[model samples]
Target: MSGGVVTRGRERRDQQNGQNSKTTEQKRDEEQVQLAEANSLALTMRSGLQAISKEIRDLKTEMKKDLTTLKEQVTEDVKSEINDLK
Candidate 1:
């Protein structure tokens, strides 16, 4: 009877340990899933920022071209006026 009692106690302790191990594994799995999601979000935001930055650079280049053309046109008009006055 004492041997049976000891066996039963050991079995219960082993089952309790198994449950704790499973719980720890579950928490670890959840943390890993969360980390993956966070990484995905960060990548998406970085891609969006890169696209917006490219667009801004393109607009700046276009504005500079427009300014250069305008300056040339104004200089031509002034030269014409001076030649007419002479």
Candidate 2:
């Protein structure tokens, strides 16, 4: 309700808790603050995820390079053994 609907049944309850209720302006301000905080947290999380994803990609590339190097080294060793046998 806009300011709080006052029904006969709720009259007493309203009277008692009226002071505890927030004004619409106060509620709006609080909601805006909460939204801003949520947006900030979402941005932070997104950036964190991006950083992790980049790290993973870099690691994969490095791993592939290392594996290729190891394979080449093994091939060279095998060729050297064949030459020795001949």
Please give the RMSD to the true structure for each candidate, in Å. 2.1, 7.8
* TM-score on alpha carbons, each prediction: 0.77, 0.66
Once model 1 is optimally superposed onto the true structure by TM-score, how far is the C-alpha of residue 68 displaced, in angstroms? 1.7
Q: Which residue pairs in candidate 2 collide?
A: none
**In candidate 1, what are the lDDT values of residues 1-86, reduced to their tens digit?**
99999999999999999999999999999999999999999999999999999999999999999999999999999999999999
Clashing pairs in 1: none
What is the total number of backbone clashes in candidate 2? 0
The parts of candidate 1 lying over 4 Å away from their true place are 77-86
Quote the positional error of residue 21 for candidate 1 in Å.
Answer: 0.9
Model 2 error, position 53 (Å): 1.1
Writing each residue's lDDT as its tens digit, candidate 2 over 1-86 gives: 54465565488778657755657667888999999999999999999999999999999999999999999999999999999999
lDDT of 1 at 50: 100
